[model samples]
Target: MRAAVYIRVSTDDQVKHGYSLAEQREACCSRARILGAQEVTVFSDEGISGSTLERPGLNEMREAAREGRFQLLVVRDPDRLSRKLAHQLLITDELEKCGIKLEFLDFDWKDTPEGRLFYSIRGAIAEYEREKIRDRMGRGKEQKARQGGIPINFDVFGYQYDPETGKVSYLEHEKKVVVEIFNWFTSEDIGANGIAKRLNENGIPTRRRAGRWHRQVVKQILANTVYIGLWRFKGMYIKVPPIIDENTFYRAQEKLKEVRRLYAGKQKHGYLLSGLITCADCGNTMTGAYARWWGKRERRYTCNKTCQGYKNEGCRPVKYILADALEEAVWNQIQTWLMDPDRLAREAMGQIVGQNDPREQIMVINKHLASIEKGQEALIDVIAKGYLDHMDSIEKKLAELKRRKEKLEKRKEELLLAYRQREELFAKIDEIREISESILRRLDDLAFTEKRSLVRALVKQVIVSGRGVPGGNGLRFINVTVLAKIPEQKISS
Candidate 1:
């Protein structure tokens, strides 16, 4: 039977047990040869977690198995296949179904009942090993959390965690985006849909893709406590590098509360405007109400608990507004504001408002290069002293200095790129600024669809006044609030 040898060495195992990639491959090959396999194909996954099935070598082996390239599988141990019983069982079941025999070098497969018991025990031992590993990890994370250290894993966006020092720092660029999200929701009172709409319109990068923003992405930003220098681990809070202060975090939470209250009790009545409308009287957002109006079908926005219960008190019951009518109003607003030539010009100019100065970046790079040179001289002097133990320590210092030097070189390159693109960057900034300025200049220039998009971007909530005032006035009082840092523009009289 043609046998495929599988080997795996996770990063943690490699560090703790000196389980080098070469050693694992050698052991697997030896076992496969000892088992008398006619053909041997090796599958190796290095520095990869066995918990995930995304390993490249594992995928290749599985594909080979399906294609009848191998009728038997050999491994150093069951753990090499998987530490999780579920995964192990699934793979073994699949292999059995495919008429492939799986053999473990450390495990003897005798035809007797006692041998079967041994096999079961071996699987149990593999599971125990996984459990022990998990327990140790959990304890370590919990300790780190309690000691005010952020849990170390893959770098979380908007955060920079130092593995050596166990300290966390915020990624400046991403933190700014996070702050903008909070400002949009709390100060602007923008809902999830509106936040998402605005982000997509502005070409902001989303969390899922390399450079795309979504509503869920904004929500995650708002919910994250890293902005406040505190993280929630297992439902408990641990302090870390703060992106925003406690006050801002609390305000964002309050806005989230309001959003939940707006949709507390409602049913879907239409698309687009279904979850956007809110009541102005009770401060409760309206829900979509659908029914047969006139001869054709129509959708309306209304409040469940509109006016105060008392007849003598509170604003009168508000009239239901058609979704299409409001949507048209919004689109018209967008065209007038976003597509205006003068406004676009102003925004293009404002695009480079917050760019890093080339001189500052150069200064930083020069400082790093100077330090690296000093470190190199020191390392040479230490080497000349002939102190073997001190030489080992100095070597590490020299290596670290070299790494820093490389990083500075890369930063210098990036600074050069930024300098080259400075003009374009400024134009881009002007574009965004112009878009915002145009909206302030001509609110009437927008078409129905454009206005809707604009409202989603600038105007968070539109408060439609309750039924006619004391003397039955026909005019409705509509109060519109804008997002953060947006200039309040005076409409041309």
Candidate 2:
């Protein structure tokens, strides 16, 4: 007789109960030998959970069993196969189909109805125990966060943790690197790639001593607020010693956001108005591309309906507009706006005042919702008073009420979100107004990304009209319409 012994132990099981894979393997092997099996194979999965059947050893054992390599499969306990009842039955059924008998050294009641019920109960209890342990650990961590205590398994770069005192202190050398990264990004306007290249060129080691510096690593270091003495854990912020000042941190954040917005999509050609430009014909946003025209590479913008998944259902224009001419025209118009600070300020202030108050609308919706709830309660009372004949009509009215309630609830959420965004929107308008002069002075000296950011902040959309034939000296009939970022107000009729 040939026999295969399987053993498994999870990390938590090993830590809590001192259960060893070796112990299970030895017991199963002894049982196999006592059953008079001459050839025995051992399969063991260590530090792997029994809730899944993806274990390497278990898979190999199943393959061998299917090959008729063993007459019997031996495990120390039923759970050594799987902690799930469904998985246990599945594995056992698969082995039985392959003409291999399963033998559990701890129990021989697998064939009985009572044993199957007991096995299912045990599996359920094991799963419940794992869930309870996970929940308890989560609650403990959240409690520690609320109490301002350091998390047990917390690990972050640029800081050293003292386990005994539960204190995190700045690593002096790493702290200097962090400050330098921020300064290069915010003050010098160096991008993440350039910063990473500089760090690697200087032979500076990453947090993991041997790891190479990466652009993503530099970006993460720049984005982390931990250097500003705040440890954010489970929605709680714990105060620590500061390494970077608030002003530098916030400026870096603003620069990052500006860069993200400027080059949001595929702007590989670095088109000035890639995301901001829209085709007046198809109403679809234009995408930047390079096309060869008469043996010359020409950068152009075209309606991106095909790329946007519209396929054959979009406007196909005869000719694409030159990128340089369109961008130059838009830039001149922005320059005109920048030259008039008074007009720009007045227009921005007008938009701000014209914006509707979302709070008032929310109050009105709430009042209507209260009335609906009262009507629903009255209908329920009428139905409860043995009004069985009105049940069908009442149900129809109730469903309609529910639909309206849902519609109003969704509207309320939208209004609330807009209300929350109102402050930030107004602040942006104010900042644009305040910096109008400074921006005009540096308009010519600004970098490509900076110019793009300025244009995106000030202009809502650039509607390009009329297509021109390629190979021409310039656009024959290029008309660019610039829409300023003005808030639209509802007109009372």
Candidate 3:
């Protein structure tokens, strides 16, 4: 007869409760020896959680059982098999299906109905007890928070947390950096990346003292309201030492919003009518093209078919419109609309045509996503509190919550995209009348980059008609039309 012994101990179980694999092996092997086993094999998983089915030693034991390498298996206790009740029953069923006998020193193994009932009840009680323990630990943190205490040790860059006292204190060096980041974001024309680079050049150490300062870390510092004395903990904002004033923090937030609304992370190209021109003859969107002829470098808008890597199945006679002529025409048209707010409002009001508002559906998705995030935070809170003894169950719960969150977030993005253009158009209309009044006074005086941004904000696309007839002199323009976005207020607030 061949026999197998399985033993397991998580990191916490070994350190806190003194559960050792060597001790379990000593006892399980002795039990196997008494069972008249000629050959015995021992499988052990150390520092790995039993709440999951992905243990190395446990997998080897299951495989050995299936291959008939062991006709009998001995475990010190059912908890050694798995902390999860579902996994315990699954492994037990799998072993029985393979015709292997499972024997636990602390548990009876019988094929009778009463034995199965008692095993399932005991597994349920163990699982319930584990949950109660984690719940108690989580509740303790909440109770501490309710009593006006700082329970967690993770402080932001500008603050230091003492675990012994659970009190947060300001670190002078890091607080100065945090103040500088906020000042740069609010008062200077520099972006987050520029600030991060400046910090790295100054040899600034990160909060962890691990590596160079990251743009995300800088952004987080600027965005955190804790700099103004409000720290978010378990959905509650506790008071912390203020690193910066409220006005500076709010200004930084506004600047962040303005940056996102304008550039949206994409670098601006030099073309004025980029991604906004259509070839009327071939129904192809025109693209900007730059070419040097002799001593002259010229920019023009041409049909997509004329570009390299694209098949030349374009109009019978493809025409290239000079960038200067097309831009001047479009800019003049935009200046006219901006100068006349009424016409701009009328034209742009119904321009963006979408089926549903999507705001209601988006609100629903946001609520669902919030619920999923709350569940994830609760699980993380327990794990973060050093509850690694039952970490497998928490990990499983976190994974499930994250999967649901990703699905909801994906749906929210789709809905947001569907409503982006229309909402932005209407939103622009709401503020355009006053903005255009000021902007029109200096429209032509705007720089090339500013002009491109203005053109992108106002104009949707340009459609030019007729092809250039190869005349005696050169290619000549036939006609040009500008479709400027004049979003009007259609829906009520």
Candidate 4:
């Protein structure tokens, strides 16, 4: 007789229930030999839960059983096959259909009604235990979150977690990268795809040590509020040390929303200036669209609201501009700017110095914060002194004060962060000069995506007007507005 022994042990089972994979394999093999089976095969799924049949070993065993490789299937118990009653019955029925008899070493229960009932009861108990374990773990996590502690055993990109102390701290190097990501997205006009490309070009590894960065990964980082000192878990927010200022984070979010609105369904064309271009006449975003011209399909940027939909009724005579000509015109201007390091430095420094000083504002915030703290203390004193008549009003006032204090503190942090970022930018002006020189020297050698990133970093908007040849060099108007720091240039072709 040919027999196949199957065993499985989840991680929890190995730790708490003492059900090691080796032990289960040994017991099943012993039972297979006792059944007088000559050619026995053993299939084991280690650290695999019995709730799912997706285990490699289990699938292989099922395939072999269907091929009539074994006359009997042996397991330590029915729950070893599956903790779910339905799965156990289905697996047994499958084996029976393959002309294989199912045998349990720990019990002989499948044939008789009482035995089947006992098997089902054990399976029910196993499933119930799993649910209870999950419930307990969820409760534990909720408790930890309520206490403002790191609950999950996972690491965030720019933060380090201490499992023993349940404390989280910023990883300085990674935090700098996080801040740079926000700065590029919000200030440099680089979208998530551009950021991901830049990270990959710079050989920056992801949080998981992945060799490449994807657009989705960059998007997740931009959308995560954790960098702003708020950890959202199961609808609860816990405060942490913020990596990026709240202002920058929210600004990035607004940019993301704008990008979504502009390039909502036009990703397939891979337009270079999809979200960055605006129709000069309509004052609406110009989207990438195709038109039939001279019996050929030509790709062009057009104001969709003016051309297709009636959303912008004020727009008359819809505008369509050649995609390639506008992209090239903008790219050429950006390359020219990159080649001039002195101009770049002057413009960047000017913007940095033009920022408003936040010290006075921060001082005022501190005064209000102090007042709020005193008010909270006074409210607590009143409550402690058995003044129950106006308890509700007192509590409401305290809550309002606390909310105001939080806002003021958040504003102060933003101001301080902005100041620090300016100082850092001033210090790194020389490094920026060198990097721009390198990029300018190798401008033509960069890939299309890399060129797109460079253009997005330097140019804020590429306003297009009038029609031009689809693949030709002539365009009616192309205005390349460089970033706020740099002087805007209008190129007419």
Expressed as tens digits, the lDDT of each residue in 1-493 for candidate 2 is: 8999998898988888777988887888898989889999998899898889899999999888766788888897777898877898798778866667778887764657897788778777877886898899889888877888886655777788898888888888988999899999998857887888788779988887885677778778878888788878767898778889999999999998887887675355688887887777767678787877678888887774432113333455444778887787777777877787666756666765667799999999999999999989989998889788979899889867866876787699999998888777667766766688788877789999998898887778887766765454456665667787753211110
- Candidate 1: what lDDT? 0.66
Candidate 3 segments whose C-alpha is farther than 4 A from its true place: 15-17, 264-493
Best of the two (1, 4) by TM-score? 4
For model 4, the run of ten residues with the poorest summed lDDT: 306-315
lDDT per model vs. reference = 0.66, 0.79, 0.79, 0.78
lDDT of 2: 0.79
Look at candidate 3 and tell me the lDDT of residue 291: 52
lDDT of 4 by residue, 4-34 (tens): 9998888888787799878887888888889
Tens-digit lDDT track for model 3 on 70-160? Answer: 8899998899999989999999998886668888998886778999999999999999999999999899988888777886775588889
Q: Pick the candidate with the highest TM-score.
A: 2
Deviation in Å, model 3, residue 444 alpha carbon: 37
Candidate 3: C-alpha lDDT: 0.79
Candidate 3: worst-modelled 10 consecutive residues by lDDT: 484-493
Residue pairs whose backbone atoms clash in candidate 2? none
Q: Model 1 — TM-score against the truth?
A: 0.47
Candidate 1: residue 239 lDDT (0-100): 73
Off by more than 4 A, model 4: 260-493
Candidate 1 per-residue lDDT, tens place, 204-294, comes to: 6654555445556677778877677667787778876677778888988888877777656433333354445555566666656664555
Q: Each candidate: RMSD to true structure?
A: 24.7, 20.3, 19.9, 29.1
